[model samples]
Target chain A: MLISSIYKIPIVILLLSGSLFFLGLYPDISTIIGGVALFLIGMEYMEGGFKAFSGSFLEKILEKFTNTTPKAISTGFFTTALVQSSSLVSIIIISFLSAELISLTSAVGVIFGSNIGTTTTAWLVSLFGLKIKISIYAMPMIIVGIFIPMFLKESSWKGIASILIGLGIIFLGIGYMKEGFEILKEGIDLAQYAMSGYAGIFTYVLVGIIATIVIQSSSATMAIIITALATGQIEYTNALALAIGANLGTTVTAVLAALKSNENGKRLAVAHFIFNMTTGIIAIVFIYQLAELVDYIAMIIGIGIKNYTLKLALFHTIFNVIGVIVVSPFIGTLVAFLNKLFVSKKQSKGKSKYLDDSALGLPSTALSAVIMETKHLYENAFGIIARGLNLKKKNILSSMDLDDVVADLYTSDTIDIDDFYNYWIKGIYGEIIDFSTKAQINMAPEYAEELYKLKLANRDIVEAIKGTKHLQKNLLKYTSGRNRYIKEQYDDIRKSLAKLLRNIHTISTSNEEDVIILLLSKSKIHAERDDIIANGTLDRLIRKGLINNQMATSLMNDSDYAYRISQNLIAMAEVLFIDIDSDLKKLHVDMGISDEEAKSIVQKKDHS
Target chain B: MSIKKFIESVKASLNLNKFEQKGKKKAIKRLLQKLESRKEILAKIHKKKLKKKDLKELREEQEIVDLQIKKGKKLLDELDG
Candidate 1:
């Protein structure tokens, strides 16, 4: 459809150019320029259309299967071969990968696969475009395609029709381009100059790289080289060198993409660069031998070596195939070495402070980074909660030991906890709250309500941690087993705390948050559990003789902390449900604790 | 390996490709139920006063149940993929 739309400009230029030819009127330089413009646009339109239509399914298949590194590489090569253009496949794969819709190792495989797949084009050009008659079938293909859309009802069928029509148009465009070149073929001395006087192998190779980079089509570069070869303007040796350069230069897009990505993207790009470089170097070292190999194959197959264009294309295909097969076993080692070389020191160390600011321009890519970062942060928080909860279970000798352990955990790791607390957590919650409130005001209630609940849950987690410093410093001091009941209360709370922490640790990865919320909502049960321990401690205090009022009060302080932690957690659950009014105070109130009671406890001293 | 074989391996890794979707879903549900039942039995056994030999047997049973759940989940993930 895109080609058909863009074909309008080209058709007009082609008509004018054709009229000049038939009327014996020599077309001006402008008409030649117009023809070139149309040719490029048609090629691009068809290529872009094919790319978009197949990209989604390709991504899905690659993502579903590429579990291991080897699997990833193999999938990459096969899929690219199926698609026909490594450049086209690479662009799609990189975009999906950058968006984290696919894994890093799999992207590497696809890169390898695309390199091998792209070689198929040169082989097709060499075998069929040179040997077979495409012109007869080309006309029929156009006719069938132009008429198919009239009968198709399904949207997908129409899309397929568009692709078929696009294919027909592509061939027709190629025919016109060739004919246009022929019309002016005899008039140009520039062709002879290009072959011998003006340029050599070095120049031709440079031209190939520049042409591929600019036209963004190595096939077009090959066609141009073939046209030169067909017209006897360039020697076979030089043409072969240009083909090698074109392969190296076609990797420009992957390299540029890496500039805007993290280490993984850079690593994939480096792998592509190394693959091309390795093959290019090998071909250069044994240029004549490889050329002779292509010649031998052509002669054995009875294709005959008359067409220099065909032979050059054959050489291009053969070299890539041989290179891939030879390097397949060592591809992993090459990728690792290249990754180590190209990936920055910081990135290798896993401290990628660089956010690929370029990602901000692309919302999908930025959103992917944000989701990954958020998941990381969530996992970190879960870790801390796990450690803190497990303290109650561990038989730590002193409050100091528990405090030292928790403090050490917080201090370690490269993440800036202050930034994590102030920016990510607060920033995410702030946006959610603002959006929810604004949406509610505008009467877009459902999403707003959801956001509101999430805000409450997040805020409650912060509140749960608010009194942690005091608890960590004092809780273990109550372990004077002199009063058997107090010591037992300590052990029981510790065990329950451990169990609570364990549940929380697994909860985030859990398939259903329903279980977590159910567990959290049993806040009243937690309160009962705390009371049983407290009552047991009081009975022991009365029985075990070493009891004082101060000791009794310290035991009460521990009970209050348990009550408060459970209340905050319950608030978090209600908040998750989007219960807007479920604050810390409201939760405490629901747990039958007054504001004064909570305040008085916060001010209470450490009996230890 | 040939590219074709590699692609076949990839296709084979997906859980949905291995079993009928309905059967796979039923299997997951059954496994989850079995796991829950096993946990309840272990918890009950842990709280009871028992012979030392019986306690050791219960511990072994717990290990076996844990392994069963892990193996089942691994296959489930492969199927889901």
Candidate 2:
């Protein structure tokens, strides 16, 4: 409470100060401020639209391209340029890094490319923003965007609508900004107050940094700078200084974001901070030389000398590219340094690995985080279930002989499954359910359906754990030198389950669709082998007077528990691993045996 | 025109409904190809003469794959319709 109060003080004071200044410079400043707000809102809409493209589209590209540093850099560059949201790209990268889906070095390379990619926005605002009557395009785009989803009714169409609306609003905002500056120019020639040399550059740079920090988007700040420059509201040098400051401001956001992130996240944030800070400082130091280079480029490209806005955009791109060139060789060193600096705290095994509040900004990242965390839960449950069955998980995961795997017991004593569940499975399970609920709000209908299935899959995991816990009680007691027939039955149950575990492990690891299909069918067949009642194996044991009624009851109940565990695990696997973005995913359910089909297969086996 | 009428006109002109079916058809075709090869492999293994239990499991797998191929073909025909 005290910390939050203290945090609000600075925000309150900033708002009050802004209000006082705005009061002095009313109406015109209000138009300008409102325009900035519209610009930010437009960007929010645009990012939201682009995020709808995220799912396997971006994940596949990043996965395919991020094997090497250069490949990663190009992937990051092209993706951000196309998406128009470096922050969106960054969010996904951070989420990926946390998932350990992409490596740290590759993530850093992508961030570098994104910095250069963001410069395209400056080019866009300079080239087209001040030229045409944006309002003409703006109004029609808004109308068209509003009507698209009404007619089409697809998430992709909604994404298209959002983008059109976003571009319309952005253009409209720029028009308002141009008008506000023209109005403000009559009363105050802000250019008259311009300072020269180092003093002027430093002051303008500081102003630029503050503007970017306030806006939380350097691209928006750059747009404002370009618009103001075109309207004769600011000198070119001062705009350049502001550009440098805007670059620096991104670091502050990264630093603040790092405060709450996990170790890998913090490391990535710090890498971002270092990259931006280095780029900013280099831009500041080479302001003059680079300004001349921009002029030379302008001449070569046929942009007029007086086109300060275009020059500023060119300068922004040049420095970022130069920064990338200078920094590329040192990425290895930086990664090593960052790894040492932000070591992970003694993280509890129960803590959610991928679920973080930062991921909530986009539906795709949030879903990925949940999926990754669920897999983590599956890993822990896999360990517990193996132990519960009195078999070493390693042996099940390995290419060991099945009889040998079952022969090597996991524990001589009864395994405390409830304790293991409390320590590992319970907390992470709660987090996934809670995170899924939050992610559901912004999700499209398709994404919502996926999330719903995920929740069911998670429930299946928990139930499987519970079933294992139930079966563990009898497993240890019966497997210990009991009646020979009951002992054989229990041993058979252990061997069959070990086979199930091994198949599930193989299914989880294999990518060949046919292999996955075959293994899944085989797993179902093995699970059915546990139904002692359906096959009358239990009845025969009782009829032959081999085991007592108490033993019969325990064996029957334990068999049901074992069977349920297999059913739950297979159900979970079908959702988690089999459901993918491929033709096999489409055919998997239909091709996969239904219960009746499995029963038929079982009946055939019994007859044979 | 009603919204539904407009939607249908747009969909009809663009043939957008066919896009998913096209992809599904392509997928089924690929799966059928793979399933055929799996049947061949299973047949090859049968000639090697496994033990009774192993032989039963292999035959069961072959049957399941055969059924899946049939299901795939049926789904493809329905899609074609």
Candidate 3:
């Protein structure tokens, strides 16, 4: 309810806008909204068409070009610039990264590129293109975007539809904005006093930033700026300032994204912030120069680029491209600076939160960020598992309670391992799984498998984390008993588990496919160690007079169940490397006894 | 198409040259074999006049195999092209 009430503030502002328009105070409302809608829709349509046309090529380019930070940043920047929105680029990169389909560094570069990419919108708006009543263009785009799906069987056409509809919405908004501004021009005196103070420029700048932050769109902010300029309330100088502020303001996404990210996230945010800040300051230093440049170019070309709106947009483009050229070479230095600047505080160490819900729509990018976060968690899990095994106390053996260990093993551990199931994975997997029930729907079966592999991987990690937790609980109980061999056995198992977890960490974090397969193999070794734990614990129990005949039988049952759970999780990991049938057969046959048998094996051992 | 022939059609198209790497080719082949055998087993179970409960598992397996084949084929096409 609290969050809902807060959201109402924006809705209320939009409503009051209508009443203000009736009073003829805020001009260009219709054209502003219409242009925005058209621009957004056009951008979306163009992006989808381009992506569909170039998905494979893009993937390859991403694969080849995303090797270094600068390259990645430039790739992301250029891609978004070509397409006109960084959000889409961010979304694509995030999903690929989250899927472990791409490297983290590449994903980070894409995130930075997305910021530069979005600047294109401001430039586009400043071109005064939205003012031209591109309704003729809009009609054809709408028709193609809307009807292409009916004609084409490919799913990419649907993506095309989204772009087209997005353009339609943008144009519709621009048209509305134009009407709102015209009404204001005829009746409102509010315009004359609107810029009464020098402070108004700064206020407009801040307002531009705040509006973009609220809408999560810099293009929309630029559109509103254009509206102001067209209405005569705001001068070109003030509008230019607002445009600069909007560029800096849009960097908030990367900053918030980096808030709890690892070193890579912080680097991306810093790169974006520096890039925008540098451009903004440069633009200010040469505002008049830039104005003259646009005027001179227009005069030379004889195209009457006298439209302040068009000049502003041109300045935006030239400024950012120039800024990128100047700073891209120093991407490495900037990244290092950010790492030093935003070091995680000592008090809150090892808690890297990632893949916030804010990133969901950009599922790929969100997933990428979460993968980085998950890698952190996987490493921690590895450490815990290792620490559990190597705990050395001679008296730790004396505290051994084989009976309780056996009993608890029969029942599953109570710890919530789902913490390892990051939100991006869940959101993506959930969508795919939900899509499975669409009986008559034609869908890419590969889509489902992609989702399945992700789900399985996350599920595997959760189970492994739980396994470590279970091992820790029982090891603690046994080690405190002053049983030397039990203590040593516990320590050995801890070391192996830790090693296994570390291997998983390396595999999960690295984009290298071979490394991932190697990690899967290493995880499989945990199954063998688990067996050793069973046999060793049984031997230790027999030596301590702890295992009576009945206890021996129960111990066997406990081993079976524990083995099954561990294998189940391990199979999930191997699924990424191996096919389902082999994985399933391996789990059911080669790994150990059956799942049901394993469950009862631990129970029978506890009873014996 | 019958699940068996559908699988065979997918398998016959599994040209290794079409794959970019040995790993991918092997992966495709292994998955195809699994689907082929799983489908055969499921069909046999169905022909045996198995009860609904016994058939339930076969149904899931059949669906999975079907999915696996399609996915593999699509992947192969994308890589090859």
- lDDT digits (tens) for residues A1-608 of candidate 2: 00111232354345445545785657667667667767766877787777775545777787789989898888988988887888778777777877778999999999898888888888888888888877679999999999888666778778889998989999988887788788889988888978899999999989988877766678778888988898899999999998998888867766775687667668877887888788888888889999999999999999999999989989999999888888989999999999899875565888888887667756777777888888899999989988898989889888988889988988899879999999999999999999999999968888788889889999999998899889888778888965878888888888888888788888888887888888888788778856999988999999999999999999999999889988988888888887457667777766787877888888887887
**Docking level for model 1:** incorrect
Winner on DockQ between 2 and 3 is: 2
Q: What is the two-chain DockQ of model 1? A: 0.04
Scanning candidate 2 chain A in windows of ten residues, the lowest lDDT window is A1-10
Error of 3 at A381 (Å): 5.8
Please list, in the order the candidates appear, how each scores on TM-score for chain B only. 0.64, 0.90, 0.60
User: In model 3, what lDDT does residue A43 have?
Assistant: 49
**lDDT score, candidate 1, position A585:** 17
Chain B TM-score (model 2 vs. true structure):
0.90
True lDDT of residue A557, candidate 1: 71
Superposed on the true interface residues, model 3 gives a C-alpha RMSD in angstroms of: 14.4
RMSD of candidate 1 to the true fold? 13.2
What ranges in model 1 sit over 4 Å off? A1-73, A85-113, A124-176, A186-199, A226-238, A251-271, A299-310, A325-371, A387-608, B1-81
The segments of candidate 3 whose C-alpha lies over 4 angstroms from its true place after superposition are A1-73, A87-116, A122-132, A137-159, A179-217, A224-242, A245-277, A295-310, A325-337, A346-361, A365-566, A575-608, B1-81
